[model samples]
Target: MEISRKNRRLIHTIVFLVLPLTAFILFVGFPLYWIFITAFKPESEISSRNVSYWPREFTFANFGEAWKNAGFSIYFKNSLVMTLIGIVLILVVSIMTGYVLARYKFKGKSIVYLILLCTQFIPGAMLLTPMFIMFSRFHLLNNVVALALINTTFQIPFNSILMSGFISGIDYGIEEAAQIDGCSRVGAIVRVILPLLKPGMVTVAAYGFIACWNEFLFAFMFTTKQASYTLSVGLKSLIGEYAMNYGQLAAGAVMAVIPVTILFINMQKHLIAGIGAGAVKG
Candidate 1:
């Protein structure tokens, strides 16, 4: 007996796709699984050289300790507020800049873009000294407002460049037609352009939030006060001279990952819709 064509194809598919998919899943999911399980494990289990896949003992004390003793509660609130503020500013500025870059031609436009691109390659650590000095001079140190402003400044260049490409995908004829139908320039942009730009905006907003949320260097450097420290900074503070609490750290990480995961799941629908809409329009 010989294998049928269908059976051969099925074997090939399994070899080419299913095996790789399973491997990839295990590789990617293992760290997340380990961290999540570790968050529930007792300190003794976490420290032992003989590590088990399952927790020997589970406790909620880690989360409570993280929230209270580690100052994650304050850090979480500060991170949320700061990230939101940065995202808003980035969105507002990027939209206008992207629209202009996409729809208009002006002197130094290419040069401006080149500068923005170049700025992305510069080491943020290298800028720390000047930035700290500048902040100190302006009394902006240890301030969430200053942190938001710094995040916005660094984020805007890349985001605006990306949004310009997104804006270019939109048909300008719609805006022109709206203007012809008694819509003012501002109104045309507000009504026609902004609606079309929602997907790009959402995408950029998510990116901005993640960037600001994970940003440790600037946040660590600028925020000296516990009340102003972001989650990343606060997590770094969890490491002590003599004692390290792995469970509390893992719990804090899990807590931080949850909101971003929820947000991504929610926006995934819009991202799919955006792809479909683009395909239709194209």
Candidate 2:
């Protein structure tokens, strides 16, 4: 009877938890595994009918080809610059906006919140034409700065709400203490509040980086110049109308995944903390 009961419990655990988790892992991990393996495979093997689970021949040639021949070098640089600039702009604007919403009581505060909330529901595609016209009028077409700015604009609404949650989670007494110690409002924020906000800021930055790095439509439509193409656009360009280089395409994808992967791995702890704190208080 004891052994039978133990067996039933084990079965229940497997069915309820282990099996589901394993399935989820396989579902998410298989594509990434395939991409990694395909990236190393030679072109001949890649296009071959034989479905090998592993690469028949490993080579770095694909990465080299993608970087040099496919112009991923330029794309990589542009993505890095644009993502960094966009993150900075996002952090600044989100922090300030968040602080105001969290700490201040002002006229039209509810309306402002409603407007910010509504902006989140607006699709980026809807604004593309008008944005294109505006950028054209401003002579900012094919510009990395302009790309960063647009990305920042799209990202700020949610980030501001998130930032407000984080700011609200922080104790007001801390800022008051800083002020009592001869720190002005700006100085208190600069020295005390900002340092305390690091985890939240990191969370915001990670979100901004991912959004800016993966943005395809804006980067594609706004920049016609090959020299101005970002990694997302550059990857799209690899799809030749008639024939595509699967090997180089896979290689470019792997390259694009690296920075964001590293970032999440490093910032995972802070991300979880920030999210938990925000959820509790927001």
The candidate that wins on lDDT is 2
lDDT of 1 at 256: 86
Record all residue pairs in model 1 with backbone atoms less than 3 Å apart, i.e. clashing: none
Residue-wise lDDT of candidate 2 within 162-190, one digit each (tens)? 89888888999999999999999999988
- Candidate 1, residues 82-117, lDDT tens digits: the string is 999999999999999988889999999988877877
Regions of candidate 2 where Cα sits further than 4 Å from its true position: 1-3, 272-282
Report the Cα lDDT for candidate 2: 0.91
Per-prediction TM-score, please?
0.88, 0.93
- TM-score for predicted model 1 compared with the true structure: 0.88
Residue 104 lDDT in candidate 2: 96
